[model samples]
Target: MIVAFDFILLLFVIICAIAAISVKDLLSAVYILGAYSFFMCLLWAEMGAVDVAFTEASVSAGIGTVLLIAAVSKTKRRSKD
Candidate 1:
């Protein structure tokens, strides 16, 4: 059961990664990257790396996402294509 959950989590992470890269909108991509970071945190926690997971959550998913969004807000929101 745990392995199944891990497999699903990994699949979602891969999907989120692809979506983050493929999205044209900068803000949307940042949000998707944040989601990817969150999923990574979950994966780490599941693997017993609690410290790494918490760091990923607080730094990557939290402050990192906020900073990316703020940076995007200061620039153009759309892509040239």
Candidate 2:
């Protein structure tokens, strides 16, 4: 059951990463990247690295996501060449 949970988390992280990189909308991409980081934190916790997981969760899922959202809010959501 633990292994299954890890596998699912890993799969979600992979999908979120792909979406973050591939999305055209900047805000959506940033949100997806945040989601990816959250899953990574979960992965770290599952692997028994409590300290690293705590740091990752606080930084990536919390501060990082807030910063990214703030940045996105201050700029245009789409880029044009």
In the range 1-81, model 2's lDDT, one tens digit per residue, is 289999999899889988888898998898888889888988998999989999998987889989988998998889541
Per-candidate TM equals 0.93, 0.84
Q: What is the C-alpha lDDT of each candidate?
A: 0.94, 0.87
* Range of the 10 consecutive residues with the lowest summed lDDT in candidate 2: 72-81
**Alpha-carbon lDDT of model 1:** 0.94
In model 1, where is the ten-residue run with the lowest total lDDT?
72-81
Q: How much does candidate 1 score in TM-score?
A: 0.93
Candidate 1 C-alpha RMSD relative to the actual structure: 1.4
